[model samples]
Target: MEFTQPVDSNLFDDAKVVGKPMQRIDGPLKVTGTAPYAYERNDAAPDALYGYPLGAAIGHGRITRMDAEAARSAPGVRAVVTTLEIDPLEKGINNVARLFGGAEVQHYHQAIAVVVADTFEQARAASALIEVDYEEGTPADLDLDAAFERVQGTGEPDTLVGDVEAAFRDAPHVIDQMYHTPAESHTMMEPHASTVDWSDGEEMTVWTSNQMINVNLKSIAATFGIDRERIRVESPYVGGGFGSKLWLRADAVLAALGSRAAGVPVKLALPRPMVMNNTTHRSATVQRIRLAAREDGHLTGIWHEAAAYCLPGGRGENPTAQTPIFYAGETRRVKNHVVDMPLPETADMRAPGEASGLMALEIAMDEMAEALDMDPVQFRIINDTQVDPANPDIPFSDRHFVECLERGAEAFGWSKRNTTPGEQRDGDWLIGHGVAGAYRGALVLPSGARAILDGGKLIIETDMTDIGTGSYTILAQTAAETMGMDVADVEMRLANSAFPASSGSGGQFGAPSSASGVYAACMALRDKIAGNLGIEEASFNGGRVTGGGTDMALSEINEEVSAEDAIQWGDFQKDYAMGTFGAHFVEVGVHAYTGETRVRRMLAVCDAGRIINPVTARSQVIGGMVMGVGAALSEDMALDRGRGFFANHDMANYEVAVHADIPEQEVIFLDTLDGVATPLKAKGVGELGLCGVAAAIANGLYNATGIRVRDYPLTMDKFIDRLPAV
Candidate 1:
């Protein structure tokens, strides 16, 4: 079904299940520990061997010699495969670094060898017996400060709209500043793991933890130089991804190789420390923002330049991606620069570009508001634009940015906030309020699904993954709404390569795109049923089909029916600019004596089109809020520049938000729909919640202490000495 234009009448208009707050259907299995993860699939691979991987000790080097004789002779050890012994494997299409079978190490903790044994302990013990000699080389640049000087443009030098320099110079109000953000880890609950069973070198089946199952199937096939149909990938449940599991990792590749060598199925689970260094991470960024506005608080020119490090063939982080669309400016410029570094592969995490970009841009907005002596919320309202700032001809499909701000401010009691820092005090605490706007583009991809109706029960099958974002529940809701049945009556089978491919969870596009696919498949099924009954049209309600002056139970149809369909794009994306908008309001209390900041309350007003399931959408928004809090005040992956690796590579040293750290959080979704997005009229809300959240917290800290911080994590040390006297 090609979505060429706005849907005339969607099934959700009188929805009984789609918009309701429904509990997740998979919750019972997860809480009872009945769900099988990658490494715990003992029932399917009962005779599976355990594989322990050995990673490179040096970041950049060549393996001169490897001695695995002792490991081969170790007790219970079945086989030991090293990079020196195996044939060089081709890099997967979606992979930036080769998983295994290479002499030259590209980054720290690159997998070097794998030892398979009868038990996990045996494999771990045997792995330590292998010895390797490496020839180290001069490390690549690891310092963002020094690398910024040698940074090169990434493809297009800059996004130029008008005369930016002239507009900035002529503006009456101008603010310029530089901001820095450190590298971050995904810190998902489950580690990267996989279980592989190869059959006589002809076919392979892998039970793995990943986001995109089809991508994994193709990549694994490419790496093994086998037919695409020869591999089957299954990821029934994923603990969490946050973009870390979007591509093929070393766990699956090594497990497949180990299984082949040992003549038995093998399972590999990356250790805690290895998950940090061997996988991808969000790269650090250095951003410089210049805002020029008129005296009346209208923005005239906005210039954002960002530089970040990436591997030689990797994509760089673009922190200026949201600058050209956020506000109405006569002139704007955005530039992205990439610096070569010898570090772990950098990739998307959460909102990626917008997360770090807004951390700087929103703070710059707050600073400019102060320069104009105006309310920050009012300043944002004054520069609101309904059309794309870069190309005014393309208007936004549905934008409620002003409504988000006004509603959030009213709900958060913005009128009572004290504007002057250090003036409002309660005993030993200073109080302040802050606000930041959120923006993230809504993206849709080609997605397909199959629906089967058997004896009044509807079953939907797709390769979409949950990844803790409620994909299963929302898709079930879509099926239930379309079939005119309760959500409990619909069974959803997902994340299996055998199922129809879907838009696997990433970039906040999973929900809308996958659900639209389900909608199309259901529509096809409805048409088939109507044609079989010899009616021109049919209406479904209360498990009964009515058409042509006849009503009958849907289950009375003797023959089973099934249909499959896909949602393809036409020209909607090219004609209109579609994005999700939100507003974050935060209240903070600073300890006058210790200079510590504590969040008192938080609220997010989002306009992300029609929400499929409010219960799941709220959970996603709250999770993002917690992550944003960590980004603002705690999370930072310290770099060991001398060694070209992350210093705090384990969870012990890396601090994230605990239950006690988060106060009460409220999420309010605006009643909206975007016809240009899909037939479902729903957009993504996962990444939009975190877009401007960190900046709001930083702005609150500044309002409370009168000290502005341009660096991320907003650690207490950055403002301890600068805090005013009690």
Candidate 2:
């Protein structure tokens, strides 16, 4: 089914399950501790040996010597494989550093060796016995500030829409500032783990914790120099994957290599410290924003330049991506500069570019509103654009950003907020209110699914991963709604390469794209059922086909029917600039004496088209809100510049927002349906809930103490010295 035009009506229009607040069907298994994570999949490979990975000692260098004789003789140790024994492996797609093989180290914690043993403890203990010596290279380039300075006079900007400098010079109200967001870890509950079976030299099967199965299957086939069909990747249950597990990582590769070498299945799970330093992280960004506005709080031009560090030949963090189309501006300039730093690999996490970008851009918006002495929410509304600012001829398919702002302001009691800082005090606390607009472009991908109706049960099979976002529930709901059956009667088999390919749960495109695929497959099944009944057209309802004077139960057909189809989008994005928009309102209290900040309450109003399941959607929004709080006031990966590694690489040293740190959070979704988005008429809300939340908290901090700090993770020290007098 090629989606080219807007859908006027569909089976989802009168949906009974798709739009309802349905509990997760997999919740019972998860809470009962029966759902198997990758590391605990003993049933799949009961005789699997354990493998422990050894990382490089130096940040960047070549190994001079490796003495693994001791580890090879260790008790229960089966085999020890080192990088020096083999040539460098081919790099996978989107991988900046090789997973294994060769002596040269591109970054700290690069996998260099694997020790296989009878037990996990035995393998881990044996790995410590190995000795390695490295010829350390010169200190790596780990500083973002120096990189920013180096790119200042290099060349023309990456993107230049119009005369931004002239617009800034001629504008009456203008603001220029710089902001910094430090590196952050995904901190997902489950670590990177995999279990590989290669006992049969002809075929290999891997049960891993990953977000994308097909992508990993292809990567594994490429890394092993095998046919794509010879490898199978399965991830039935993933505890959580913000974006870290989107690609094939070291654990799977190490396990596969160890299994092949030892002639037995092998299981490997990266240690907590290794998960921090070895895997991908959200790169730190230094962003400079210059906003030119009119006296009426309307934006005239936006100049956003961002600099981030990455391995050579890797795409860096893009903190200026959202500046071009977010608000109304005649002239806009957005640019990104990448610095070749030999640090850990930096890649997508949660919202990725928009998360860091909005952390600075929205704060700048608040500052601009102050310059104009206008309400921040009103200022945003004044600059809302229905059409893309870069290309005004193309309008958004659907946008309700203004409604989000107005409704959020009203619900959050914006009128009660005190205009002046330090005046509205609660004894030892100073109160403040802040608001910021949220933005994330809607995305879709080609997805396919297969539906089988057998024994009065509808089964949908796809390679989509849940990742704790309720993909299973939504897909079942879609299948049930399309086939006129109860959700309980539908079975979902997901995250297996044997199933049809799906969107694979990333970039906020999983729900709509995968659900559309299921819808298409069920529509195919509906047509087949109708044709078999000898009806030109039929209305399916209550498990009966009613049309052409024929009314019969689906179960009475006596023959098993199956159909497979996919949803392929056709040039829709080219004609329409579609995005999800929201508004975040936060209330904060600052301790006047200690200068500590505490959030009082928070509210998010979102407009992301039709929500498939409000229950899971709410959970996703609140989870994003918690992560946003962590990004605002707590989470930061401390870097050891001289060593080129994350110094605080464990949970003890790293900090995240806890339950006590979060207050009351309310999420409101606007009643909206985007016909052009999909036949399901739904967009994603997972990333939108996080986009501008950190900036809202930053604005609240400023409103509380009258001190503006551009640096993120707003620790108390940043404003303690300048706090108002007690």
Candidate 3:
């Protein structure tokens, strides 16, 4: 199919800005310490009071009463605002619990009160003086395996399709295995923080670190029965949010309440220890994947059952979402079973659905390939479907999954992988290799942007957040490419509620959806300019009209671009399922004595459609892959079953892959275009790189030691007991 997307051949033929190794546009400011964060925005309020948080000591219980007598008598204490003193808080749009937990404590370290003082250290000292009496209730222990038996049905409490039972009975080769993964924390560089200054009665202005600025504005305003427009939430530069900062948290609420009570602005940021349990996290899961393949090695029945624990209202949205897209099968059923637990609720993280799903599914795929005695790449190629497997009518905008696997295999040197465990030994280590396909569904959300062209420069503004994924640069590139201007001439201002709403920065939707909004405004501007030039807009693309230098002639040909021009939904996304697909190949070596698995080399090939900025795109993929390695080999939020809480709340016990633990990494992008996606024909690459990543590494461990581990982190203790009788 011919591509309708415009090519930057004139300027980017050698891939200058499109594929060049350009530094992040905002990197200098961030490194030089000029980028202001939520709690660091000193100009938002004058002489702001310092507000320190108070967390619940119990995992789950009710606060019967609180004593602020000692705190009030403290040296620098100004005021103490608890949930009892503040206006009743409304449930946030995407939040499951109240920001300040008081009546019934939801989870460990849930917010209870804030002590306002003249100094941060002084406020922190006063916060320790508030005494809270608790009426303890037996906490619903947060173990996926313990409550899995009682919880039945899928994510919606009921799920089914086709005749999976009969198909499984009739199949020749079948594999039924259970996999377990522990809960994980976002652990972003910056903690959840906010600074609020209340002025003009109920009117409040908040500087918070949040992914969705407008959501925070509306949620914060509604919390105290105030007008939605009365509260202004500004979050222009956020440090990082791996889905942890997606919505307003306790910090914002505490700051606002403290400011009002003390009659001064208050700044509040959760301490490092408080960040672990105060915010939501990636939940633990127990998944059972049963695959039945026919004698000819074709899948007949596929059953995926996932059991996870969350608060009553918390749901793992579409946990089994990837099963429908990858392969073709007649009898298939994927279900998500959730149990109500007093543990912290699970919320969205990068690649929320597929990151954990692929950790189990793709490893199962590796087992199936071995059982069928077929090459893993060939097995994937055989089961590849061009159309959506669940619904045949919805065709992929373009599916190059087969090509990704084929090209990746050749580039990854799969022939060198011996395919035999323990036989391929390298001196002090056992070496092996494995591969898994990655899939993340494409998402298109209605978005809006406003652009202004003055003189020769173009400025685009939106409420979309960057989150350290090169959002500003890519948005600039998209607007520049569309308006046919130099990239340097384009300016971007993002993450302000005064701007129009975008899809926001969840699920890797920022690049395609927000940039598409810019495309719409640019198109309208071009059309209006053509009208003033007395020329048909359709023919204006072929030539440039020159002779207007800062005069009415230039203004005559330039059109006004506003938010209204970019708010309409288009047919670009509905006609095709615009997705990004890839595969990860891993080579690992496990220590014979210590039983430590070390990744030797890694490679990934992605079909993400016309990468707008290669530098940022490459950074995203490499960073995601590193995190995947951490998930497979080291990271785990271990629970103290006796205490009914996370034992490793700090980074000391919970381990992640360090720089020494990392391996040689490489990334590849397939060249393709999809005008149906947007004017830029690009999909989000941030989270897509992580899908199916852990499975590839886990499978590589299997190849290395012949040990089939069903639990995540692949801890040394699990294999130390079973170490081949040295």
Candidate 4:
């Protein structure tokens, strides 16, 4: 479809700032240690005091007895606030577990006490000294195999269409398998942190690192029984947050509470170790997938069931977000289930449902491809659905998934792949090529933004957090492109409570949803300028901000217009469905002797409409691909069932991909203009990168080996016994 003003098209097609790979705007500050992360902002803000949290040592248990004498008398200790001592702290909508001062032990390291101190070091040293006796309640068996026995019904228990059971029963060929994935960690460069200095006892200001700031502001106020209007939270720079920092985590709340108690502002940062247990972690899962197909290679039926662990208090929900709905199946039901384990609050991670689900589904597809004696790419091509079979009325906004699969296949030379595993041996290494198509909807939520035109400059402010995704640069490019000016002409002030509430940077919505807000506001400014020049708003249309019969500086328009005088838009999402698509191709070499696997190369063809900044978007996809590789190969947070805590609780044991682990990576964006998604005709490119990625790599590993392994991390240990004999 055509757009009134081709959304974000200039970014990909223009020579100014769109396609050109430029250095990041914040690169210098980051390299020189000039940028201030959350914990470091205390120096400039209304500085606060220091508070350190006292964690529950056991994973599941009640605090039977507590001793605070040593901690209270410790040097510089201001106040020792334990669970029973403080006033009730309300629950944050974004937070499933309470921030602090809670008696009931729901999960591991649930904060039961906070030691307020004059100095951070004192709080730290004293927090370690506090001792408590635990009832040592029996923790839930954390093993997935044992837990799924009583999984009962899948999540959202009953959603049915065609009879999957009868269809699979009548099918000519069937493949049923179970896949398991351990929980993983984010390990972002910075830990969870917050600095708080109250505006007054009833009010507070926190310098924090969280993806959603304004939402947290209200939640924090509600937690303390104060006015949301009284809180001012700001986070101009964030090191990185894959998904862990999305909500109002403990660091932000405990610090505020501690600061209130100390009567001086307080700063609290979760020590890297404490952050993992004190907050949340991705839950471990047990998944079982059953696929049935006809002799002609048509899928007759499919079933996906996934189970994950959570605290006894919280219900386990669907872990299978994206099942095989991408393909056309007459009878299919993808279900999710949660098992109660003595685990911490389980929440979202990047590419949540697709990430883990794909691990099993895609690999099974590879196995089915082998059973049918068909090319993996061709198998995907036949199953492509333009209109959702499950919900046939909703057509995709723009589906280039077929194009992605075909282009990716041609680019990766899939035809050259070795059909037989262990036969195409490169001396000691076996080479394999595999592909998996990615599907993720580009969602657009109502977003509002206000631009300030001050002194020949446009200061664009939104409550969106960058989260190391280069959001600021892309947003600036969108505004500058709309205003017909240089990117440098735009200044950004984002992730602050002072700004209007925004869609707050989750679900890969920043570039698409947030930039659309900026685009709307800029259009308003253009109209204001046109009116000032006596040109009818509609008269000065195409490529014309100020042209024939119109000449006026933007400064005059801002002077005459009030903030509310600016334009606002009505609901525009009804016209079309906006989404992003991509296909991931992975190459891997599994060692024949040692069963070691290393991802040799990877590529992704993405369609996220117009890439606002190619460099940043490429970085996002490549990073996501690497993360996908990690998920398929070597990333899982192991929980010590006996100890009732995470076994690899720290970075030393937790594995995330490093540069050394990655090979040459590539990403291609299908340039398109989608007005239905937004005025920018752009969609989110940040997240779709990892979606269906682990599946591709896992499928690739299977292609390299006849044995189809479904579980995640595709660990060699799991395959060593099944390896083919030379």
* Candidate 2 segments exceeding 4 Å error: none
Candidate 1 to native Cα RMSD, angstroms: 1.3
Tens digits of per-residue lDDT for model 2, 1-726 = 899898889888888888999999899999999999998888989999999999987889889999999999999998898989888887777788888998899999999999999998999999999899999998876779888877854667766778888999999998999899999999999999999998666699999999999889888888878998888899999989899999989999999888888889999999988898899999999988999998878888898888998888887688887888899988988888988988889988998899999999999999999999998989999999999988889999999999999999899999889789667789899888889899998999999999998878888999999999999998999998998888888999999999999989999999999999999889989999889888898887777778898998877778899999999998866799989999999999989988888999999999999999999999999999999999999899999899899988888888988989999999999959999998999998889988999999999988888989889899998989999887
Highest lDDT: give the candidate number: 2
Residues forming the 10-long window of minimal summed lDDT in candidate 3: 538-547
Q: To one decimal, what is the Cα RMSD in angstroms of model 2 from the true structure?
A: 1.0
Superposed Cα deviation of residue 263, candidate 1 (Å):
1.2
Clashing pairs in 4: 7-680, 48-265, 49-265, 49-266, 155-336, 183-637, 442-579, 674-681
Candidate 1 per-residue lDDT, tens place, 19-98, comes to: 88999989999999998999999999998999999989888878999999999999999988899987778888668878
Which of candidates 3 and 4 is the stronger one according to lDDT? 3
lDDT of each: 0.90, 0.90, 0.78, 0.75
lDDT, candidate 1, at 503 = 87
Over 1-726, each residue of candidate 3 has an lDDT whose tens digit, in order, gives 112343334322333345445678899999999998888888667688899999887777788898888998899898898765554478777788677744787777888999999999999999899988887777455556766655644254233557889999998889999888778887788988988887345878888899887777778776677887887778888888888888778898888888888888899999866777788778888888899997677888888888777777887534566886677777788778767777766788778878888899998888898899888888888888888766778889877999999888999999878688766888888888989999987776767788777655678888888889998888887666666666787789888888878778878877878877877776666666555555553322112333233123333434453433553445535656667899999999988888988999999999887788888999999888988988998888877655456767776766767799778989999956755565566677899788888999889988888888889988788886665544
Using Cα atoms with residue i matched to residue i, what is each candidate's TM-score against the true structure? Answer: 0.98, 0.99, 0.93, 0.93
Taking every candidate in turn, the Cα RMSD to the unseen true structure, in Å, is 1.3, 1.0, 3.4, 3.1
Per-model clash counts, in order, read 0, 0, 1, 8
User: Which pairs clash in model 3?
Assistant: 154-336
- Displacement of residue 5 (Cα, Å) in model 3 is 13
Instruction: Name the 10 consecutive residues with the lowest summed lDDT in model 4.
Output: 560-569
Candidate 1 lDDT for residue 328: 95
